[model samples]
Target chain A: MIPDKAKELQERNLKYAQIIQDAMSGKREDMEKRIKELNLASTPKEVIHSETSIKLYRFIPVKKKLHKTPLLIVPSLILRYYIMDLLKGHSLIEHLVESGIDTYLIDWGIPGDEHGHLTFDYYIDKFLKRAVRKVSRSTGVEKINILGQCLGGTIGVVYTSLYQEEINKLVCLTTPVEFEDAGLLSVWTDRKTFNIDKVVETFGNTIPADFIHACFQFLDVKATVERYKKLYNNVLDENFLYYYKALDQWINDKIPFPGEVFRKFIRDLYQENLLVKGKFTINEKVADLKNITCPLLNIVAKFDHVFPEKSAKALNSFVSGPVDYHIISAGHVTLVVLFPQREETFKLISDFLKK
Target chain B: MFMDPAQFGKNFMDPTEFNKQFYGQMEQVFIEKMNEMIKNPAFLSSISKGVETGLDGKKKSDDLIKKYLEKMNMPTREDTSKILQYLQKIETKILDLEDKIEDLSDDLKNLKKEYGKSRKTEKKK
Candidate 1:
């Protein structure tokens, strides 16, 4: 017990000494600078196509021999697209590129006030369709694979349901299909509790980023504070500090959901639970999940607080095609961003795509 | 560092690790409580009303500002968005025209080739 106590005291003393040494040697400032200057999403990519609020990117191929069917990554519009290509060693895009899958991504750029009127139909019919066509033309493939994360997965599922001929395979990571079971978000956006029309009328074009950020904060204030506390505890550890700052940067980077699209998403999907019911429409045509005849890989995070696993897994029952459903033991963000889990997630995606 | 025997025995576990565990448990419990509160109909009603009131206030202020700005003959966000929408329409038309032009060009090339082949056939005859 004495030895243990001495060891603990020694460790604490050493940490203090290290901090003092770092400060005296001006190392802390350098470390802070390095953290601030860390090159996130460093994987090199070229923009293949660009329109109003969307830029489709094709990552520069790392391998000589590439897969026949190109994989298009569609990330949620809530945050930046770089979550797939977060850091040098931690990037899903890097892992896929290294594994010889031809990778492309849609960067839903920051929406301007004019883009407020852009509806779910406009995105699916105009932007996403154009992106798919561009990918097909560029890669010279009749059909391509799609990997959509979160809300992007919903878009992919809807798109595939509408135009099944264009997709070879569909991948959904932590994607919500049955919004009725979408936990707190569903509860918050319930027609009885929330005034969607009033909010839309007040905030003309799009919900402000700050409003979205506040919603996230309200979801779990303790967890949000815990993140900062963890950072403070590990401030002396350079490796931890680097990743912490990198992720924190992304956490704070919120984007406004386009107004009309937000309205449809909440009303049609969350309130009415129309997606799984086969009533969700795009461009005057109903999007029936049964129309998705292509192979699908639905990845669900077991502890996803944002969208529950069962909510994500609902896609499996609706589709007529073969489904490869995987429930990884990770939270929503950790499923793609954090270590071990991300590596496993990447392997699953790459292996599935190769097949 | 010198440590008393009794105090030393009690300090076997690191304080930081202990704090982390305590914090984790506290956070989890707090989050659970928050989630419960979020689901409460009364809580939801209050939050909904509060947000709507705030939004109404914002809208009224924005309208007042817009009116003042219009009186000054200055372009507002609405004006800019209108212009942008017009430009977007024009751009879409241009793109459609470009696609048509490319198709027409391809068709013209095919027609020219067909005409040349006919002339050659006539020469042979």
Candidate 2:
């Protein structure tokens, strides 16, 4: 024997619940439709430029240019080089090419068991040296302007210091020469909890993925998660989705760092801090940054988490070359691809190359 | 009320058979709608387009992630601990080596100076 008023209230409540449920179902359907629609509309291309064991990529430019000094980009072997030339509108390679700069990138290909015997000395003496010579000869220039990013930059610095006569203008982006200033990487190498020799010997050319992943996880874990979430939310348009997929593919593509090279990097650069201290020796020749005489353009990201400002900035003091250092406003990846940064960094690089 | 057997047969049905018939109709309706979507050129094109776009976004994201990881300088826990162990051992060895090298250098310098002084005395005599 419920009251008449209570019965009326219950009926109304049930009706309201039904309406709300129906609306929610409609929204769910809409979201599913959107997801399917997006999945169907995507057009992504794999742009890998590989030569021998080395692989890299170039961004296609909207506009073509006339004659320009071929710019050879060297990215760290640990990661793919596509970050520099990210997408159509916000690509360093596209921007440079449109601005009349001929660009070529060296991709350090995925290291396999065969590359286990390769060392930093091997990279410097064999691959980088041969690549530079080949590019120079192909371009009909005695010396080609070289730009190296991160570890690649360190290699470039060493190469330029040792063989300045072969290289014209050298550009180093986030390259760490002084290991003491390298922060966590330096500390870890100095401690030696991970036996580089044992790992290298076991895997040959391949360093473990778990080991590399752990290094990055230590730095701002939350920020990394938030970035992807924001990326998914912000990219509502078709073109942005294409760009996103392209970036995603390159991000997950991990390659093993060669064992001998890993050992040398940890022992020589990180532990001894030899390159900047003028105590580094490669191929029986004392490698000194003071020997670099070419025009140098050192680009350092102000908020770089990995290489840090101190490590990159230390290059100015070490190199004897006419150096122009630009402290750009961005992180490491953003230096190459982000809109405002692309304009700023490219403008500076172009201006220096012209000079 | 007087009911005809034919009328009752038309109005009422067996529960199991009725359920089966109802479910069969619903399944047919769903299949028809799905086939319509599959056959629609515009819908298929849209799906293909979306897939292509997603793949592109994935590739770019991968590149950025790889680059970021490559540039990051943070040390792993294992690396940090190992470095600490190595530092302790190296420090001891370096200190011992430094002392030995310093002593040897001082002895050589003193010997050179004394030999110079003796040669001068001999000349004077």
Candidate 3:
């Protein structure tokens, strides 16, 4: 190697040595105590309806109720709902609630073998519709606005198309609309090579949460390594430690996806790229975007690795009504954790819904 | 441009700035390489192919296990799953019947209320 390169390599080794020394100097007990103090999803809410395994909750009023249309936040079914309200002051739901936005969330309880046959159609037609009706009756509103993130947003897109009259507005966050050239995860789930039927048959009923996490971890091995290294480097900082614990806890706390939903999601959405092509269907009904007349707001994370910004922005072209497309300067996880991005996302949801 | 020895020494002496620059460069290079690897068609295609092959192997192994279990007169996972599915179907049917019964009961009560009101009116006449 060149002389300058050799010198830099030596300096880098020295820096690593110093970093290791500083990292070791932090008190072990202090780190343990801080981690133990990290609690998540402390927001109070009442379960208004429970249909078998699914539950719909109404967050207790924090700010004075001003809005007629209650905003329902759909939980990505594969993951637990509390990531939206991970911690006090850092919560997306809390910020909206305190701002006087009528907010609700669906807790898709962990799927068991009994729920294995519950397809996307069953979820959207039977459960989602019932929840919307429950909210509408209680709030005395004809139509409600829905905010769905990630896979939940994909569900929302389908539901809004199917039941256009029920929804007043649609807000999708980091939702993959056009799957072509999307990201590493998309590439890995290519239909021709991936046997969805075999995987679903083998797993049976519900795919374990650990399986999904492992797959996501494989998407970026380097990022995973860098994240842990950064974690150790900042273990001494109490604030960083708290948020890290909260986020990490939320990521690990996941729900097994209903098997039928998983199969359809992989085959139809990811494999065929049907939603963007306007050929996606549920229960023999065409899920045409033109059928969706509700005002749409597509919130995309610019640096999202799972659903890149280009894939998410495709929503703008499909929607018939006015589409408010907002791009934030954050990655997928940071879109929820970082204060500025989270705050901005919360603000955008409330504002777009009210419009 | 080659840095003189004195300048390099000055940069190294300020450990904080040097560390920041070093890590920044490292992160930039790491991300670029990762992105390149991810976007490579051969890499992605190979991953899918490998996963498919592994899946096929799993399915074959599962089939063999089920065959052995059947020969020993043991209940297999498929057998148990089918039983569970049947039970779930029965449970769902029962729930539906219950809802229908509740609706019929409400209708009967309403009919009785109207009869009572009509009888009272006739008695007054």
Residues A201-319 of candidate 1 have per-residue lDDT tens digits of 88988888778767776666667767756655676678786787677666655668888988888899999999899999998899999999998999999988889998999999999
What is the TM-score (0 to 1) of candidate 2?
0.61
> Cα miss at A152, model 3 (Å)?
0.6
RMSD (Cα, Å) for all candidates, in order, is: 6.2, 22.9, 6.8
Please provide TM-scores computed only on chain A for all of the candidate models, following their numbering: 0.89, 0.79, 0.88
Per-model lDDT: 0.84, 0.66, 0.78
| Clashes by residue pair, model 1 | none
Model 2 over residues A1-355: C-alpha lDDT tens digits? 2366456546655654543343234233453353343342121222333333564333343346534566778888767666675555666666667766766777786665556555689788866776676567556787888889889999888888888888889988888887785755554444334344544544444575445655563453444554554453444445654555555444544557877888888888877788877888889888888898888999998878778889989989877878898898998767876678768888888778777
| Best-first order by TM-score | 1, 3, 2
Superior by TM-score: candidate 2 or candidate 3: 3
**lDDT value, residue A57 of candidate 2:** 39
DockQ per model, Cα: 0.41, 0.01, 0.29
Ranking 2 against 3 by lDDT, winner: 3
Off by over 4 Å in 1: A1-36, B1-32, B100-125
DockQ score of the complex predicted as candidate 3: 0.29
Best by lDDT: 1
Task: Return the TM-score for each candidate structure.
Answer: 0.85, 0.61, 0.78
For model 1 the interface RMSD, in Å, equals 3.4
